[model samples]
Structure formats: structure tokens, C-alpha cells
Target: MLLEAHSLSFSYGNTPALSDLTVSLPNGATGLLGPNGAGKTTFVRIIMGLLRIPKGKLRVHGREVATESKALKAVIGLVPEGEILVPDITAVQYTAYAGRISGLSSTEAMDRAHMVLHYVGLGGDRYRKIDGYSKGMRQRLKLAQALVHDPKLLILDEPTDGMDPKARDEMLDLLKELGNDHGKDLLLCTHLLDDVRRVCRRVLVLSQGRKMGLVDIEMQGKDTDLYAVTMRGPIPPFIDFLESHGFKVDVDTDGEGQIALSRGAADQFIQHAVSQSVQIRRLVPLRESLEEVFTRLVSKDT
Candidate 1:
């Protein structure tokens, strides 16, 4: 397991932050999704060894976090949501310093800093002071710093937060490469459903500091029994025919759509449509979007 928590709970004074959260996340790209105040940040902080394990067992990389935090820090990298860069330093200096903090020697830190800076497309601006860099450049620098240590698992908080369209796409592509080609495990914490859908294979959703759902992106909406069907002509007779034939049909208020039947029913449905003089305009499997899944999960929690 990449992360394992058993009865994990935390609080900030009188208010609760995490409530009996238990989950085991495997090695791969996973998205951490939630609305505001869902304890996502608090969970990341615990993984980074910044917060003490207040109530229950929490382990990372199969080591107890409460006792092995110092050693664990070397194996985990973080791209925090807020800016933590030193404005006066050059990008190389900043990245090298981060590598050194992760326990690398001076020579290795400098070398890796240069390599990762180039990897993140910041080679040209590496010598420039960070204060002069734009928001996108700064975000890239943060990613470079996180990669400097070459940690096994990267915990990123809003990596594309302020980026424009082009920059956002570039950053997402980098994330995909790191996960697919470079063999790095990632925990992407963000509010953007599209980002999760694009890069992550699995998602862990939280609501009000509790686990709401864990979903596999590839298996989310591949319901072989359900399909979206559209047709032209008398909708009432077609719907009646389907209902009478024991097909479950959910029609829209507009009376122009239906979702029903299994793969075996496809031929029969088409034949019936033709017999009823209804044009089979469109028929396909219903694949639910990530946005729809997120909304459903959060709303259920409420």
C-alpha cells in the first residue's frame, strides 16, 4: 500500500477535521477529491509528517508514520498549494536547497536540481531569480523542487491552480508522463474534476472529513446493462413498446431520450424502432462523466 490509515481521526481544538477515516491506497496515480473543509489538506499534512498522528494508526510506504517520520520524509515529496519559495534565490539554488533538505549530498543535489529543472521545462529560466518569474513558471519551479529528491510518492496540492489554459495542459501532460513513463506514484489533491479525470486512474473522495467514496476512473460508468438511446418519430409508442417488453427506460422530461437495455437488447430495440417507424438516431453505452460522479457522491453525503 502507498498509504494506509486505520481509524484515523484528527481535530483542531473543538472542531473535528478527520473522523475515523480508514483507507488503503495502492501504488499508482490517485486523485484526492473533496469540497472545502473536507480534511484533504489535513490528510496531506499528516503524510508529510508536519502534523502528529493524534488518534489512530497511519502508515506510509508500510512504515509507521508516528515513529518513522524522519526517514519517511526522504521518500515523499510535496508540492504545496501556497507559495513557499524564497524570492531572492535563483531557481537552481531553490531546487538544490530542496534536494539537500531531502538528505542528498551537495554535489548530487546540484546535479539532480539541474536535471529536474530541465525536465520540468525550466532550464532556460533556472539561473533567473524566482521573483521575476511568472505564475506558470513559479508553478513549474515548485514541481521541480518536488522532483529534486526523486521521491517515490509525490503529493501535489493544486499544481495547476493559477495557470492559464496552455500552461495547465502542459502541467497535466507532465503529470501523465511522470505516472505512466517515469514510474512515479502520485497523489493529486485538487478540486478540478477534469484534472482527476485526465491524469488519475483512481479517486478517493472525502466529505466533511470522512471517506465518501473510492472509485476507479476506468470502471466508473461502463455499465454494460445500461445504454443511452435516442430516436426520432413517435417517442410515446417506442417507450410503450420498450416498457411492455420489460426494458427499463428512463426518459427525460423533454420526452426525446431514453436510457435502457443490455447489449443483447440492442438488435431487438432497433428492430422494434423500425417496426414502429421510429428512426434510431443514436444508441450508445452511457459513460458517466467525472463531474456527475463527484456531484452524486458529495450530494449523498449531504
Candidate 2:
């Protein structure tokens, strides 16, 4: 596990920010999904050692968060939510400064700054002042600075908060490459379900200061035995047959049918198909969209 939190809880004076949360994030891209005030930011802050952990236990890279925070800082790079860049400094200068602050030698910091700027697609404009850059460019700059230290894990907070569709897509592709090809573990903190669906392999959903649950985004809403079926022959009888046998059924155009029932019912469904002389051309389980998963989790928590 890259990150492990057990019964983690936090409070802001009288208000609870996190409550008995337990989750483990593995190597690869994971999303910290929640609406505003859902404790996502607080959770990141605690892991980064910016905030005090008054209760529970958290381990980052197998090091206790509260006791070994300094060591964790050396391996965890953070791209914070708000604007933190100096307006007058160029991309290289700012990125190099970040590397230096992370304990890199000035010479090595400058070398890495150039390399990371190019890596983040800022090579052409590496000399531009931060104040003059567009929103997308600034976002990339934050990523470059985060990468300047060459940390093992990258935590990005709302990486695509304000961007056009094209820019958003480009960022997602870049992140995917970083996690998949470059061997970087990434934690994406965002409420946008589409972003998580596209970029993250696993997700931890939080709501109202509590963890709704963690799920592998690819496998979410797949535990149920709801399959989409398409056939070449008549389907009406098959649909009726399923419903009469306590299976939920939905029929569509062109001999498409959807059946929801227990996994045990599969044998029964198959047996019925043979008896009814219906050809089972194709049967695929329907996958729930990220939006559906998020909505279901939040609603159930409420």
C-alpha cells in the first residue's frame, strides 16, 4: 500500500472534518473523490504532514505519518489546489526553487527544472513569466514544480479545475502517461466523476467527513449479476420468461435484452433459453458509469 489510514479522524475545533476513516491506496492512480467540505483536502494535508494528526494512524510508504513526516516529504510531491506561484519568476526559476527547497543542490535543481518543464510540455515557454501564462499553462507549471523533486508519489488537487474540454483531455492524457509509463504513483483529488473515471484506476469516495467506501473504478458496480443480452431470434418470450422467474428484465430494440438477477439464476436463464429455442448471441454484463457509482455511494451514505 502506498498510503494506509486506519480509523483516521480530525476536527476543526467543534466541527468534525474526518471521522473514523480507514482506507488503503495502492501503487497507481487513485482518486480522492468528494464534494467541497467532504474532508478531501484535510486528508491530504494530514498525509503531507502539514496538519497535525491528533488521532488514528496513517502510513505513507510504510512510514508512520506523524513520526516520520520528514522522510515522507522527501518522497511525496504535492500540487496544491490554489495559486502558489510567484508572478515574476519564469517557469525554470520557480521550478528550480522548488527543487532546492526539497533539499536538492542548486546545480541539480536547475538541471531537473529544465527536464521537468520539458516533460510537462512547457519547454517552448519555459522562459515566460508566471503572471503572463494562461490557466492551462499555470496548471502545467504547478505539475512541473511538483515533478522537479522527482518524488515517488504525486498528489494533485483538482488538476483540471478551470479548463476547456481540449485542455482537460490533454491533462488527463498526460497524467495517465505519467502514472502508467513513467512509473509514478498519483493521487488525484477531485469531485469531478468524469475525471476520476478517465484517469484513476482506484477511487476512495468521501462524503460529509466520512469515507463512503473505496472501489476499483474499473470494477465498480459490477458485483451484481445484471447482463445486457443481444440475440438474433425472437426476444419477447425470453424477456417474459425471465420476469416470470423472478428476474428483472428490460428489452430494447433489435433483440436486445437486459436481465438483472442473482448469479445463481444464470444457470436457470441458460436452461430456459434452450427450452424456449432462443439463440443467445451475446451476453455482457453492464458496467455502471463513474457518475452512477458516485451518486449511489453519496446517496447511500446520506
Candidate 3:
């Protein structure tokens, strides 16, 4: 586990912000998903050592969060939920400053600043005053500064917040690049279910300061991949047969008889259909969408 929280709890005065929460994030992208006030920001603050943990155990990179705070801080990158930059500073200078503040040598800081500026889509514009940049550009600047330190893990709080559709897509593209091309681990903190589904490989959902669910994002089931099979024979009885035998069948029309659902048991569904003497042409199980998962989790929480 790259990040772990065991029974972590925290409070604001008498009000609890995190309640007995326990979760572990691995090397790839993981989502901290929930609506606003669900403790996502508080959780990130705790791991970053900005918020004091009055109770529970928290660790990052195998170092205790409270006692080994310095060690954890050195390895983790944080794109805070709020803007923390001087508007008059240029991207290159501010990013270099960030690296130096993280204890990098002056030479290393300059090199990293240049590299991250290009990485985040700020080229010639990198020399422009940050105040002139757009919302998306500012968000990218925050991400670039965080990466200036070359931390192994990146924690982003609503990285796409307040962006137009184009900017949001661009941000998502950059996030995918960081995770896939650069191999940077990510803890994506946001309530945006679409972002979680598109970018993260695992998700932990929180609600009302409590954990609602955690799920492994299975792109394909190990033994069996789900497929949607569309055939042109006896739709009603076929669907009935599937459902009657403990299978979940969904009907659809793409100029076919009916749409049937099959899991890793593709072979079984095929055999059953053959035994029933139904002609088959197309079978496809639309991969479960992230939206489906988020809806299920949030609904259950309420």
C-alpha cells in the first residue's frame, strides 16, 4: 500500500470531520469520491500533515503520518483545493520557487520548473504573469508546482473545479498523462463521478463524513469478460429463460431481437442459448460504466 489509514478519525472542536475511516491507496490512480462536506478535503489535509490527527493511524510510503510527517511530505505532492500562488509571479519563477522550497538545489529547481511547465501545456505562456492565465491554466500551474518537487504521489483536490468544458477535458488529459506516461501515482479527490470513472483505477466513496463503499475498478473480470449479446430469435422467451435461471438479463434494440447480458460466463450463456436452439448474431455486455457504480454507492449511502 502506498497510502494507508487505519481507523483514522478527526474533529473540528466537537464536530467530527472524519469518523473511524480506514482505507489504503495503491500505486496507480485512486479516487476519493463524495459530495461536498464529505470529508475529502479533511482527509487530504491529514495525510499532508497540515491538519493534526487527534486519533487513529495514518501512513504514507510506510511512514507514520504524525511521527514521520517530514518523510511523508517529501515524497507526496499536493495540489491544494484552494489557490495558493502569487498572481504576479510567472509560471517558471513560481514553479522554481516551489522546488527550492521543497529543498531542491537551485540548478535542479530551474530544470524541473521548465520540464513541468511544458508538461502542463504552458510553453511560451510559461513566461506570462499567472494573473493573465485562464482558470484551467491556473489549475495546471498548481499541478505543475506540486510536481516541481518530483514527489512520487500526487494528491489533487477538484483539479477541474471552475473550469469550462474544454479546460476540464484538457485537465483530464493532463491527469491521464501524469498517471500513464509519467507513472506518477494519483489520489484524485473530487465529487465528479465522471472524472473518477475515466481517470481512476480504484475508488473509495465517502458520504457525510463516513465511508460508504470501496471498489476495485475491474476493467475486465479475471476469468470472464462481460459482453452484450444481441440476437434475432425469440426475444421474450430467451430473456425469460435467462432470468429464470438466476441470470440478470437486460433488453435492448440495435435492429436485433433483444439484448442479453452475460458475465465471465460467456461460454455458459452461449451454450444455454444453443441448447435453446436460438440463432445468435451479436452478444455484447456494455462494460459497466463508472456512473453506474457511483449512482449505486451514493444511493445506498442515503
Best by lDDT: 1
Candidate 3 local lDDT, 5-96, one digit each (tens): 88899989888889999887778899888877788889988889999888899988888989988877877889987878886889899999
lDDT of 1 by residue, 1-302 (tens): 89899999999997899999999999899999999999999999988888998899999989999999999889888999999888799999999999999999999999999999999999998999999999899999999999999999989999999999999999999999999998889999999989998999999999988999998998887665777676778888778888999888886534455567776778898888889898877787877788888888989989
Computed on alpha carbons, the lDDT of every model, listed in order, comes to 0.90, 0.87, 0.82
Off by over 4 Å in 2: 231-256, 264-268
| Model 3 stretches astray by more than 4 angstroms | 220-229, 234-266
Model 3 root-mean-square deviation = 3.3
Candidate 1 worst ten-residue window by lDDT: 251-260
- Candidate 3 backbone collisions, by pair: 224-264, 227-284, 227-285, 228-283, 228-284, 228-285, 229-283, 229-284, 230-282
Question: What ranking emerges by lDDT with the best candidate at the front?
Answer: 1, 2, 3
Better of 2 and 3 by lDDT: 2
User: How many backbone clashes are present in model 1?
Assistant: 0
